[model samples]
Target chain A: MDADLHPERGMFLHRLNPVAKLLVFSCFILAATLYLDVAVPLTFLVLAWLMGWLGARISPFALLRRLSPVLAAAVGLTVFNTLFYGGPREHLILTLGPLSIWREGLQIGGSIGLRILCVASYSVLYMWTTEPSRLVASLMQQARMPYRLAYAVLAAYRFLPILQRELGHIQAAQQVRSAHRRQRGSWLRRITHYGIPLLVSGIRQAERLAIAMDARGFGALPTRTHYVRTHMRPLDYIFTATGLAACALVLFALGELGLLRSFLAGVAESLAGAPQ
Target chain B: MAQERLDLGLARWTTREIIVMAVISVALGLIFMAYGVLYLALVPLLGQVGIMLLLGFYYLTGILVPYIVRRPGAALVSSFLAAFTELLAGSPFGIAAVWAGLAQGAGAEVAFALRGWRDYRLPVLMGAAVLSGVFGYVYEYFLLSYAVLEPTVQLGLFLVRIPSAIVLAGWLGKVLGDGLARTGVLRGLAITRSAS
Candidate 1:
């Protein structure tokens, strides 16, 4: 994996305070939920992807490649929703035995799938731009979160790669041992034979980590100084304020249009008429 | 050098147990990631069928952790650890992973709490499954899925998840634990003693 995708790179978005980014993201999600329409959220996805290109300097191809899994999932979700969830005022697109594809269902599913894509894109941008360590430090400093807990989270994050590497080593060692024993069992048995050592090592690693942290007086201090501080710049303020304003404007437009309850009402009406 | 305490009866790990747990965690995490991808992929068509599967994960993690660590908060910690693993593996859920961790941990905690932190009987395990399932359902419905679902539909969905958690998640966890112990690797964790 490229180091740039490590969520710890010093990119434009990475420079913002973690707490500020978190709040902005949260507000964005809330606004998306409130709008209850596919268009706005889908727009957010496009905007986020664009920002990744312009602001973070991530290539468009790279961004899309990273988002392939989410895109594939959205397609699957849309299909499932259209077929099984028939509703009132639905335009029957397709039908099979007991399963009917409804227009209303497609709209609803598309809305949801788009919302997920938008939310996911925003997060990917955050992770891609921000360093995990900086994010954790900012959370502790700006949010007044407990340092012990924050550091614990950081520790866990850092430990993951180590664990993965160790797991690989253990597997190789097991394969060698199994070969010597001339193990002629099935794949499942081979897996069982190899798996036990990895688990034991993981537990031992955790214990050692805990002991090491304890020895360092990890939880002893009431407060600690950060080697690096996150100071929000004028640009961050402008970005966040603009993001919030955009959310508010979208919500206002949705409310004024009176389209908020239409989807849910349609769903309720369809569910009620369906033969049990 | 201090002589290491060696007890053959305790079933000391010989590089085998460590590998097994790591594989299990990875496999479980991968399965979860696949389900998560499916949940997101299917969302455009169905609301979230795999959402119910989350309850099973909570139940399984709760039982599996306690079976391994035999310590307070083992279930909770393990649940978070697993979620963290998934997130690191690039779960699309983003920060929602944190909330999932908390909910799943709480579910397992409830099960352990019901046992008075003493008993590990099947009934207690089942009770834990139910408790954890309910917690997960409430969180998902109220926090995540509430806006999408009507009030009655939300309640119905919640009700349906409980049984799925108990049967699919809880039962499978027990069986998996038994299988792990039979491998003789879990003997080191003292889970075998509890199994009998």
Candidate 2:
């Protein structure tokens, strides 16, 4: 809802069409998934942060604050991969009683962790800058998504806050009725008790809303005109071209230096060879 | 309330059907966002398997929507909407959530597709959940680099995820569908029409 209401600050990224932004980000994400090396994703991570700060005009502190939770999760991933690493125990990093951390484990874990960060950073920037209304507009007009489905999604997006408020009311009413009088129930039980009422109220409201929409001939036309049209501009093309060129150049350099490790290649070797 | 004739043919969805599924999916999306955070916290103890065990929640919309709506692509649409909602709400996983949603939804839909999109019986629902778990695992195998992990660990993940999918998504979806049908709010919906 907040994203829907976000005033376009007229930043470069904000001015670009959502479709262009999606193309550029998807390019980077696809690159991250293809390569398994640490340097590749590390390069992408830095590039993503730089774009967020300079392109989107997002303050570094604000970006870091938003990324803190993801940072923590990334670190957790690193630790998990290191501890449970089933790879060959080569280039010992450290050792404890029956527990050891190896270079191979750390590399695999760190690469995956950094990849997650890279993807998250791009997505955060895009989500922060793009308006939901414009996103649907671009999706319908540029992405060729059917208007009916797109509008259905937009209608659902609008109902989120209402649903949250309804949830609060359900919890309060149940609490007053001494639903927690005895031992507290499991989280599953509690959610179910609250979920049913929430679902019923939401369904009833949705049905009423649907009838109102139908009355207004919401789906009468296959293609409808938009008040604010989202179109691809020259600047959007430049941005996409520049973003993609930078990624390709980086990958090219990495490949020449023999630092580029293809993920599929690694998987093939791992599967073909026995556990070390 | 008069029982409307159940139209099991692959007809175009009405506005009512679309809106109803969206609302339900969005609600589930909100709940799953909480679980996603809890998943990150539990990684230290349970490792990646923690996510696998908690995966049934992710598969819920995929199963629930098709069970109630019984329409072609209902599973995929609702599941995708739920994930997209999580993305808009700023889930920690960001864009990856959308891809996971697509894969899982497609997997769940396969069961109904095999059943010719008609059966809403318990077995088909559970089968949908299992197929979704399978697809989720396969997607993560490449994206999350699960291929690099020890084969046994990968096996462990597969073993834990199936049952979790069954109990959490399949059985729970049935319960929720039955509960909503009982409330009479689902009167004009396909699930109620078929029952009556």
Candidate 3:
């Protein structure tokens, strides 16, 4: 819940329309997955850290801590692909017993690692900066999302924690009934006996909620007014254009300039055909 | 006009359906949160085959929603909304969680579409569930570029997921649907209406 987006209303990034930020960030991640080239995404990963402090007003240490899973996943992915999923065992780097790590494996694996880092950094920054309500408001205001669907989703978002608490209460009550006293098949037994009743009650609550919503004429109008309006400021346009242009120049266009794929491919080819 | 629209499939969601889907999504998002924890912990073991391991468990919304609602595109919308729930609740992967929701939901939708969105037979549910797994992995494979991996390894990844999908999305969906129907909790749903 803490990471779900906080609307503190500070900094240039926070002021930008959530829709613009979401769009730009999504475009950036899309570009990363497209290339699968190492240097490109790696550069963006570094840039994301810098942007955290300069643009988004996020601390560097906080950014790093939040993005640690991505870093771990990158390391784990590199190891897995390099050791397990890579090419025809060409250009051996290390060998243990029957397993051999090839140079091509390293190239592809490292590419995936860098891609993860780049995408994760962008995503972490975006989610950290944008508030969830702002996101929904923008969707409805900008994207013309139906108020009924959007509000329902928002109300449901508010309900998740309540449901978690309800689940906890149910578990405690069942534990008092000695549900966990029997160690054998406790979890499986609990899921059926506990989960169903919980869901049944949850649905009943939602049904009642729908009735309340109707009583208020929740979706009687085609266009409803917002108490918290989201307007696209000059800052939103500037941030989006600048962010996208930077990503394209650094991640995609620069990769084309260096011909990164062919260079890696050539290095791989040489290693594969290298003489013993 | 309202009842006619519902029958003709012109209307996608009624207010009641929206509430129901939202509620279902929150409940299932809890399940997703648990899986996400397991995933973060077991990534080493999951390795390249990480996606298939999630096939069976993740798409339960796809099956349950469509089975109960029987509305056009209910499966896809349900899965997506469920995923959005995970996002609002705070997903580690951020926006990719929503993209994943779309991918998995579409997977389940494919199976139901093949049956012309009419059948809720055991085989139909099972097929949808398994395909949801296939589609999820397929989406990630392309999205993450798994084409570079060995063909045999790719095949193995694809194969291991089928059984889980069958159990979770396919069989469990059917079982739970039957149970809910017996409890008369699914009263006024399209499936129940069609049956009675």
Q: Cα lDDT for residue A192, model 3? A: 66
Deviation in Å, model 3, residue A57 alpha carbon: 2.2
Which candidate leads the pack in TM-score? 2
- Writing each residue's lDDT as its tens digit, candidate 1 over B2-62 gives 1212222112332223233333454455456766665555454545553554446445666
Interface RMSD of each: 11.0, 7.5, 6.0
- Native interface contact recovery, all models: 0.07, 0.55, 0.35
- Give the Cα error of residue B54 in candidate 2, in Å: 1.3
Top candidate, metric lDDT: 2
Ranking by TM-score: 2, 3, 1
Q: Which pairs of residues collide in model 2?
A: none
Q: Please, what are the lDDT tens digits per residue for candidate 2 over residues B1-196?
A: 1111332231388989988988899888888988778777777677677667876878999999888888999988888889888877877576888899999999998889999988888889999999999999888887878777777877888889999999899999998898889989998788998852
lDDT of each residue in A1-276, candidate 2, tens digit only: 113233345687888888889888888887987887898888887887788788877886787788887998788777777767775556888988887888988988899888888878878888888887888777777777667777778887888888889988988888898886642767667767888999998888889999999999986765566665777778888988998998899899999999898888768766875354
Model 1 segments beyond 4 Å from truth? A1-11, A59-61, A94-98, A179-195, A231-238, A262-276, B1-55, B66-78, B114-120, B138-196
Candidates' DockQ values?
A: 0.14, 0.41, 0.38
lDDT of 3 at A233: 72
Clash count per candidate: 38, 0, 0
Please give, for residues A219-249, the per-residue lDDT of candidate 3 as tens digits: 6755566766776777778888998888767
